[model samples]
Every structure is written in C-alpha cells, then in structure tokens.
Target chain A: MSLELAVLDWFFEPLQFAFMQRSLAVAIMVGIICSVVGSYLMVQRLALLGDAISHSVLPGLAIAFLLGVNIFVGAFIAGVISTVIIGWIHTRSPIKEDAAMGIVFSAFFALGITLITTIQKDNKIDLNHFLFGNILGVTVGDVRDTAIIAALVLMAVFLLYKELLFYSFDPLGAQAGGLPTGLLNAGLMVLIALTVVASMKVVGVILVLSLLIAPGATAYLLVPRLHQVMLLGAAIGVLSSVSGMYLSYYVNLPSGPAIVMVVSALFALSFLFSPRHGVLVGPRRGRPWQKLRTLLPSKGS
Target chain B: MATSPKIIVDHLSVNYRDVQALRNVNLTVRPGKMVGIFGPNGAGKSTLIKAMLGLMPVVTGRVTYGDDTLAHQLDRVAYVPQRSQIDWTFPATVWDVVMMGRVKKTGWFNRFSASSRQLATAALERVGMLEFRDRPIGALSGGQQQRVFLARALAQEAEIFCFDEPFVGVDQKTETVLFNIFRELAQAGKIVMVINHDLGESITNFDQLILLNKELIAAGPRDWVLTRDNMTRAYGGHVGFFGHVA
Candidate 1:
C-alpha cells in the first residue's frame, strides 16, 4: 500500500470509534479556549493563578458529586471562590498572592482528596481519572459542554478584544482612561474559571495549567502582539491536541499526558529556535565563547 | 486660555495602609498653564493624581472639573503613569500602545475607527515616534518609551493631561521634547499637570507649582511656591534646589 493510503487508514480508523471522536472534540476545544484565555494570564504574569484555580476546582467537583449537581457548575463556583479568597488574603495582609495561592489551593485540594477517597467506595467514579484524565471516557455531554464553553469564551474574547488588551497591558492607564476596570477584571476571572472547568476532563486539575500556559507562552516567543500571540497559540494548541491524540491511538499511551508532552515539546522547540528570543540563534546572543566566559565570571576579572 | 475652566480640588485627603499619603489639600489648577506638582520623594504626588482620577479611594473631600466631580469626567482626561508602573516587555508595538489611548473613545465591542487611527498616527508623528511604530515596546530606549506614552496621552485628545514622573530615567532630548509639548499644550489652553521631582533648571518651565510633602505646603505661581520658607518646609531644609533655579 502507498504511504499516503497507510496514513489515511491510520487516521480514519480512529474516527470509527464514537469515544475517540468525542475525546478528540473535547481535546481540541480545550486547546483553543485554554490558549486564548491563557494569553491574558501570561501577559499579566498570573500563570500560577491558573494552577491555583484548576486545583481549587476539586472541592467543588466533590461537592457536586455528593449533591448530584452538575460538576462543571460546582467546579466553576469553587474556582471563583478560590480566586476571591486569594485576592482577599493578599489585599488584607502582608502576604503576597503567590503565597496565598499556595495556602488556599493546597487546603482545597486536600479536602477534595478526602471527600473523593471516601465517596468512591460506594460510587463507580475513579480518582485517577480526575487526577490525570480519561479522555477516552468523555461522553457526548462533555463534548457539548466544552463546545459551549469554547464558543462563549471565544466570542467574549472577540467582542472585548480591545478593552481586554488595554487592561491586561496596563491596568492603571486603562482604568484612568475610564474603562470600568473593575468590571473588566471580574469578567476576566469568570472567563478563566469557565475555561478551567471545561478543560477538566481533557487534562484534569493538576495538569490543566500546562494546557493553559504552554501554548500561549510558546506563541509569545514568536509573535509581537497580544492578538497575534493568542491566534498563533490557539493554532499551536489544536495542532498539539490532534497530534497527541493520534500518537496515543497508534502507540497506546495515555491520552492526556501524551497531549501535554507534545505541547511541552513544542514549547521547548520554540524556546530554542524561535527567531526573536531563542537561545542558540537569537540575534541578541553574542558569540558563544564570550557568553560562556561571562557566565563563568573569570576568577580575578 | 481664559475659556478653559479651572480644576477645583476641594479639601482632598488620601490614606494608604493606615498611613496618610495626602491630607486636606485644597488647590485650583487653571488652564493655559504648565503646572508641576513638585515634591521630594514619597510626598504623595502620585497619590494626589490617583485620587483625582478616582483610581484610589479618598478619605475626604472632592475634585471637580467644571461642574461635576473630576472622576465622573475621566473620559476627558489622559493619564500617563510612571515608567516603573508599566510592564515594558508586554507584547505590543508602539502603534498598539498609542492606539490604547483611543480605546475608551472608540467604545466597547468595536474596532478602531479611521479617525481614531488618524489621531494615533498624528500623535505618534507629533512625538516623533512614527518611525518606530512597528517595533515592540520592549525594544525601545527609556526616552523613546516615555515619548511613546506621551504620544498615547496626546492621542487621547483629552482636556486635562496628568503625567507621573515623566522625567525619570529619560534622556535630555526627551526632556526638551516634553517641555516643548507642555508649552504647546498650555498655549492651546489645556491643563497639563506633571509630577516632577527635579529642582533643576527644568523647574523654570512650569507656570505654576504645587509643592507637596504629605500636605500642601504651597500652591501658586513658580516664584511664590518655590520660596525658601516653603522649600524648607517641604524638603526639610537641606535642599540644594536654589542653585540651579537661581
């Protein structure tokens, strides 16, 4: 058989399974939304806040299960609460936001673990799936939910592109210009919470931050504008997701981790070879021998 | 110049972290004047501007432009924060930063209009940063960066202009450009308020000075406000300011 035909068969055979189709849909949607939303976090240096929100959603997920509520709603509420507490702690005390996040997320995560470990005895749920994700286990419902979130996130970003850009770039300047900065800030938090909830099934709570930050950070290295970074980041995310899913299919690796590894590799590649800020070939990098000598800080000079 | 209304600051006060940054300060800033807010370090020059723009909560009193509270009419104001307040490495070009000045005027959920683009372009051209429009902001020198921000404020087409520490870390050429623009704005009957710490020859450019040190020490014409008594009161008596100004 021709190599083209073989590749076609390899791709087409995966689509024959309904679960594979659903998993791919969820992965792709999460990729796009995460990249778009994560661009804001990257520019603002709030990447760890993504990690905090993702982990904090756990207690909500456990509560939702206990109350028989929609896990997404519960998880989103929990994410928002975590952010509010982080804000409150940092604002009212000498402790900074990073420390606040560390304290709050760990507490929420511990509670989630206790609740889930206790409840799983009588339920069919698996804790590992929530921790690492089981993309193959995603139902049509998850696909629909993720699609709704992706649409809402993308549309909100589009409509408020200029305002958000101004705010994230320079909050004080934008606020002084009378842009209703408080409302814009609340809107950004909501968008981030929703993205985290939607992405839970694809990357889980612990690994979700990787999806949120890597693609946008990679694109930032290559692009010169926020919009360009977001667009290129979304493209990078989708490509990584699809390729990772295919790799998982052919090689029998775990889907979520495979996807993360692929995106991470892409970021590493960009880190080394991006035309502007890369390590080896960047125009700003002086001669390799001179650079090495400077790092060595010669004994007497 | 006469038609432009004066800004009325009525017994304003501000506190931060349980400490008073500014207190019971009352002053009027007339249009057609280049007004400098002169003070030593940590004297709440920034706090005063932030309070007027309603960027911070006030402890008492109000600031007014025309008949309404100044905060209510912030759309008519353009503010340039200190260079340290901004993230220079942000992923934006000079053109992008300048266009942010037009964001409020352009309104929400809309693309920038042609006239808005024209204003940004004109502002950039005025500041002589038009040639660097496509360069990322992080790549610019300190003076160029300040010039770009000045261009952003100019693009705003605002009635009142407030700049915080605009001269910090800037080159001599930028200082010349900034003073020339301040004079031009004053000549056009606009209110140009700058927070300047320099007591050097540059102090001569201002038509009025607001001397502050946690409280209003003086607020009047340059010669009146920069008197020895007021300088000693505001700067605690070891000031070498008179050397250059004299």
Candidate 2:
C-alpha cells in the first residue's frame, strides 16, 4: 500500500467501527474540557485533586459494580462526596492544603483497595477500564454523558472565572468582599468531581493526571496571559489527543499512555524552546553569540 | 458614606478547643476614624478580626455593623488579613486579586464586569500599584503584595475596613503608604481599623486605639487609651518587643 493510502486507511478504519467512532468523539470533547478546566486546576495549585479524586472513587466503583449499577454513576457520586469532604476538612482543620489533601486521599484510597479486594472477590468486573481506559469500546451513552458534563463544567468555569481566580489567590479578600467564598469553593469542588468522572473514561485514572495537568502547565510556560493560557491549553490538548489516537492506532498501543506521552513531548519541547520562560532562553535577552560578543567587547577589552 | 459607627463588637469571645484566644472584647469604631489594634504575640488581635468577619466558629459574642449584624451585612464590612497568613504561590495577578473585591457587588452567575475592572484599577492606583496590576501577586515584593491586599479592600468599597496587620513584614515606605491610603479612606467616611504591632507608630499615626490582651484593655481616643498606664495594663509586664511598656 502507498503511504498516503495507509494514512487514509488508518483514519477511515476507526470510522468503520461504532465503538471507535464514539470513542473518538468522546475523547475529543473530553480533551477540550480537561484541558480547559485542567489549566485552571494546575494554575490554582489543585493539580493533585484529580488524582486524589480518581483514587477515592475506587470504592464507590467497586460497590456499584458489586451491586450491578453503572460504575460511572457510582464514581460520580463518590467524586462529589469526597471532594466536599476534603474541602471542608481542609478549611476547618489546622492542617494546610497539601497535608490535608494527603490525609484524605490516602485514607480513601486504602479504603477503596480494601473494598475492591474483599467485596469484589468474584472479580467479574474489569477495573482496568477505570485505570487505563479502553477507548476502543466507548459506548454512545458514555459519549452523551461526557458531553453534557463537560459542557456544564465549561459553563460553570467561564461564568465564575473572575471569582475563581480571585478566591484562589485571595480567599480572605473574597470573603470580606462578600463574594460567597464558601459557595464558590463548593462549586469548584463539584466541577472537579465532574471533570474527574468525565476524563476517567478517556485517559483512565492512572494517566488522567496528564490530561488534567500537562497541557495546561505547558501552555502556561508558553503564554503570559490567563485567557491565552486557556486557549493554548485547549489547542494543545486536542492536538495531543488526535495525534496520540493516530499513533496508537498505527502502532497498536494503549490510547491513554500514548496521549500522555505526546503531551509530555510537547511540554518537553516548550520547556526547551518557549520564548517567554523556556530553559534555553535563560536570563539573556539576545542570541548566545551576540551575548558572547558583547561580553568580549567585539575587538577591544 | 455616613458619619456613624459602622462596626460594633459587643463582648466578643473566641475559644480554640481549650485555649481562649479572645475574652470578652468590646469595641466600637466610627466612620472616618483610624482605629489601631495593638497587642503582643498571642494577644487575639487576629482572632478578634476573624470572629468579626465570621471566619471563626467558636466565637460567643455578637459583631454588628452599623444597625445590622455582621452576618446580615457582610458586604458592608471588609477585611485585609495578615500578609503572612496566605500562600502567595497560587497563580493570580494583582488585578485578579483586586477584582475579587467586586465579587459581592456583582453577586453570583456573572463575570467581573467592566465596572469591576474600573474599580480594581482605581483601587490599584490609590495604592500606587496601577503599573503592577498585571503582575502575578506572588511575584511582587512583600510591600507590593501588602499593597495588593490594600487595593483589594479598597475595591470592595465597604463602609467599614478591617486590616489585620497589613504593616507586618513591610518596608517603612510601604507602611507609610498604607496608612496614607487608610487616611484617604477614613476621610471619605470609611471606618478603618488596622491591627498593629508598632505601638509608637500607632500612637503617632492613628486617631483612636483599641489596646487588647485577650480582652478589651482600653478603647477610646489615642491620647486617652494610649497612656503608659493603659500600655502596662494591655502588655501585663515589660512589653519589650515593640516598646509598648518598659
């Protein structure tokens, strides 16, 4: 087959399968949502929140599976509960943000593992789909659900973008200004819960952190403005998803890790070459040769 | 806007588990007045402010704003907490931080409007930080960060402003600039309450003083409440740190 034919064949091959087509649609929408909300989480220092939440949902999923319910519903319920509990504990306790997060996540994860091993001994359910998603078998229901939740998350974030930024940086000031800090906090937690549940089916729990953080963090390095960061992050995420899907289809590899690897590569390139804050830019404002000439004073001392 | 007592704290007491952070503190701050709250370490200055702002749960006294309770009139009073109490590494600009002050004014379901931006800019300008509005608040100097907080409070445009040690960890120039801005707010009929550590500076700068040591030691005009006897009572001994008492 010709190279062009191979490329065309790979693209058309996915459309031939209903599951693959649904997965592609779901992945694309999820990529946009994860990148958009993920950028805010990364910037606001809530990067680990997605991981913490995904881990906490394990028990909920195990119970739901044992009870013959949809794992997504189980995970969603668990996600919202855990998010609220963590936020409340962190705010009320003397423990700082990171320490509180660690305590809540570990305890919940340990409980989840225990439940999974003890209660689901029959093991009829394949939990691997939650850890490393099977994009090849995404159902139409999953796509519809993911689309609705992603749209809601996007709307909530954009509507309260100003308040979120404000409260994230200055909670005290937000409270004093009567901005309903507590309510905004709870709303953001709900958004986190929804995002985790939506992205889990695309990137899986293990690799979802990359989907939730890498593109946004990388975009931050490239852009100096918040709006630009969001736009760049979305573009990076969608591009990474498309490229990773193609690479996985051709090479017959896992979709989640492939997407993360592509995104990581983009981050690496930006780290080395971005103009605003790249490692290569350093503290100098000119080319290395120009800087060296200036130091050498051209022909004179 | 009106020349009335905006904040009134009546027998406010805050307990943390077993320890009593504040004990029966009573204070009344009028509009267009600069009230300085001074105390040594662990003197419940921050606790009092927290209780007033409903940030503390184990508080047993009522905090009122003008004719309404603080719980009912939250938007009328503003708080500028200690600069050291927050984590600055969170990603946000000075403008973003100040824009939060308008959150209450704009309410929910709406993004910060152009009017909010105007308020934020004007507040930044009042603090002489108009040029640094776009800078990430974490990237600014300690003084600049404090000024950002001040700008946030200014943007709130609350009738009563409570600052918990804005001068702490700041340069002399920043301290003066903060008080000058406080003076401007007071002149515009806003009640400005600043919790201070420097007794001498408070005595020289403020119009009224609320001396506290886990309780209300003295509350009156600076000259009457800032006496050496009142200092000895509030400090309870040789308050050598900031020379409150010899």
Candidate 3:
C-alpha cells in the first residue's frame, strides 16, 4: 500500500463517523482556547489554579446532573464561585494562595464524589466517561457547546489582556493604579473556570490540569515575549490534541490520557532540544568536556 | 501649592497577628514637603506607609488625602512598594511597567489611550530609562528597576506619593539619584512620603521627619524631631549605634 493511501485511510475510516468528527472539532477548539489563557495563567504562577477549579466544579456538576440542567453551566458557575471563595480565603486568612487552593480543592472534590456515590447508587453514571473523555461517545451537542465556550473564552482574554497582564505581574501595583485588582483577579479565575469547562469535553476531568499547564509551560521555556509564548502554546496545544487523537485511534488507548501524554512528550522534547535553551545541548556545544575528550586524540606531552 | 494638607493620618494602628506594627500613629503631610518617616528595623515605618496607602487591610483609624479619605482618593495618590517585595521576573518591559501608572488616570477598562502611552514614555525619559524602554523589567539592574517603578508612579501624576524603602539594595549613586528625584517632586509641590532607615542622611535630606518605633515618636521639622530625646525615644538602645554630633 502506498504511504499516501494509508494516511488517507486512517482519517477517512474513523472520521467518517459523526462522533469522531465531533470529537476532533471539540478537541481542536478546546486546545486553542485553553492554551492561550493557560499561557497567561502559567506566567502568573496560577498553574495549580486549574486543579483547584477542576476539583471544585464537581459539586456543581453533581447538582446540575441531579437537577437535569446542562452540566457545563453548573461547572462554570461552580468554578467561578469556588475561585471567589478561594480568593476571599487567601485575603482574610493568614494562609497563602497555594494553601487556600488546597483547602478548597480537596474538600469540594470529596463532596462531589460523595454526592455522586450517594445520589446514583443504582446503575450509576459512568464516572470513567467524565474522568477520561471518550471521543467515540461525544455528541454533536458537545461540539456546539465547546465552540460557544471557546469563543467566549477568547473574547474575555482579548478584552482583559492588558489588565490581566498588569494584575498577574504586580497585584499591589495594579491595585494602586486603580485597575480594580480584585475584580481582575476574579476575572482571571472566571476565565480559568471557563477554560476548564470548555476543556472538560475534550480532555476530561482527570487529565485537564496537565493540558492546562504543560503546553503553556513548555511554550514559556522556549519564548521570552508574552504574545509569542501565548501563540506557541496554542499551536502546541492544537498539535497535541490532533496527534493524541490519532495515537489513541490507532493504539486503542484512552483519548484523554493520550492527549496529556502527547503534551507531556512535547514538553520533554522542548526541555531537551528547544533551540533557545535546550537542556541536552553542550555548554560549549551543550555537552561535557569528557564527551568532547572522546572525540579528540590523547596528547603524550 | 495648595494650602490644604496633602495627607492626614489619625490614630492609625496596625497589628500583624500578635505584634502591633503601628500604635496610634498620626501624621500630616503638607504640599511641597519631602517628609521622611525614619526608624530602625521593626519600627513600623512600612506599616505607617502601608496604612496610609491602604495596602494593609487591618489598619485602624482614619487616613485622609486633601478633602477625602485616601481610599476614595486612590487616583490622586501613587505608591511605590519596596523593590524586594516584588517579583522582578514578571514578563513586562520597562515600558509596560511605566504604562501601568497611567491606567488609573485614564478611562475605565484599563485602556491605554494615545496620550497615556505618550505620558508613559515621557515618564521613562524623565528617569533616564528611555533607552531601555523595550527591555524586560527583570533584565534591568536594581537601580534601573526602581527607577522604572518611580517612573510608573510619576505617570500617575498624583498629588501625593508614598514610597517604602526605595533606597534599600541600591547603590550610593542610585540612592543620590532617587533622592534628587524626590526633592524635585517636592519642589514641584507634590507630597513625597518616604520610609527610610538612614537617619543621618534623612536628617540632611528630608524637610520633615516622623520618627517611629512601633509607635509615634515625633512628627515635625527635621531639626525639632531629630533631637536627642526623640532619637532616644524612637531608637531606644539603638541610639548608641549612631555617633552623636561632633
């Protein structure tokens, strides 16, 4: 078989089905949106904020499921509410930001799990589906929801780009400048929550945090400019999603973990070989003198 | 300069958990005055400034700027926090940092109108940092970073400015430059409140002094406030650390 024919066969065979097509579109959109905002989050040292929001959204999702409303709305609402609580706790309490996040995240996630177990004891919903996304099971509604959420996320990022940057870099400075630092910080948390909800369909809850942080951090190590870092991160995110989808399709692996693995691999490659500052390169040639000595002849003198 | 006092603090106090950082601190900064709030370590110097600037949440008593409370007058005042407290590696150019100062003066939504950016650039030029405008803040030396922050505060065009330990970690030459800038601002009729540790230098450079050691020691002209009695009260045992007048 020709190489072109084999490549064509893989795409056409699986993607001809509606669910696969929906999954690909949602994944790609989620990738682009999350990465752009995630770059800012990483730069601001709010990388773990995603994990906090992700876990916090569980109760919201659980309540929404019980009430039969759209789960995305519940997740978005819960994410924002939890973030606000965390911000409040960070200020009123002596605990730092990370500690506050830990307090809220664990408690909320445990509550969500308890609610799920207690509420749906008989023939419970597939927790695996939420924890690890199943591309083969995505519906058209999921794709549409992803597109709307992605657009909203992009708009928010654009609107608050400057203020967000200012707040992220210097909260006290931003506050003194009358930038409404609290509202902007809250806005960031909201943006993060929105990003999390948008990503839930593509990467699922269990692997969402990895995608939010890894690609953006990898881009950060490679690029110095803020805009360039954001652009590169988004590109990396999209590539990871596409390659991960393909790898999962072929290897019969779970799609969500596959995407995270691909993103992790990208980060590893970036760590070892990025032209800007690759770890594997020699000091002179990005290698040890001992290795260089092997290439040179021994001198008797 | 306006006849009204640029800053007023009444019965101000701050408690950092069990320790009281400030106790019943009161102060008044008139326009065109370069006032130095001087004290030894743990002297509540920073707390006084933080309370005035509303940075400390647990501040008690009242702080007013001109006719209104300082909180309401946030736009009319600018604060330059200590350099050591900030994240220098923040992904912002000198230009971006300076530009932030104008955000308050400008319209809502943190929009940078043409005039705002122009003012930012001009502020950088004033600090002799125009050449390094495009450089990231982390790449700049300690003095340059401090100057960038000063330029940011300048861009606010505020009536009152509060600085916390602007001279710490700075070279002697940079320190001189910063003081010169402070003098210029005061001469231009803006209130300059600085938290300083160099008492001898403060006596020479500042027009007024607020000597503090966890409580209000004195607040008046430097000559009257820097007396041996007040110094003894503020510094306590640390008075021996400084040589008396020859």
Winning candidate number (DockQ):
1
Alpha carbon deviation, residue A268, candidate 2 (Å): 3.0
Q: How many Å off is the CA of B148 in candidate 2?
A: 3.0
RMSD of each: 2.0, 4.6, 3.8
* Candidate 3 residue-wise lDDT, A154-262, digit = tens: 8888777777776777787677656688788777777789888878767777688888888888887777666677788899999999889888888988888899999
Estimate every model's Cα lDDT from 0 to 1: 0.92, 0.79, 0.80
Q: lDDT tens digits, residues B1-246, model 3?
A: 445466788888899866788888877888788899888899988878767777666557998886778876677778888898788876667887888787666665556889888888888888888999888787789988888889998888887888888987877767777888899989988888898887554457888888898999989887778677788888775565345222
| lDDT tens per residue, model 1, B1-246 | 257788999999999989999989999999999999988899999999999889999999899999999999889999999999889989999999999999999998889999999999999999889999999999999999999999999999999999999999999999999999989998999999999998888898999999999999999998888788889999996988686442
Residue pairs with clashing backbones, model 2:
none
Instruction: Write one digit per residue (lDDT tens) for candidate 2, span A65-184.
Output: 778898778887887777777777876777777776777778877876787777646775466777787777777888888888988988888888877776776677677667777888
Best by lDDT: 1
lDDT for predicted candidate 1 compared with the true structure: 0.92
Error of 2 at B67 (Å): 2.6
What is the alpha-carbon RMSD of candidate 1 to the true structure?
2.0
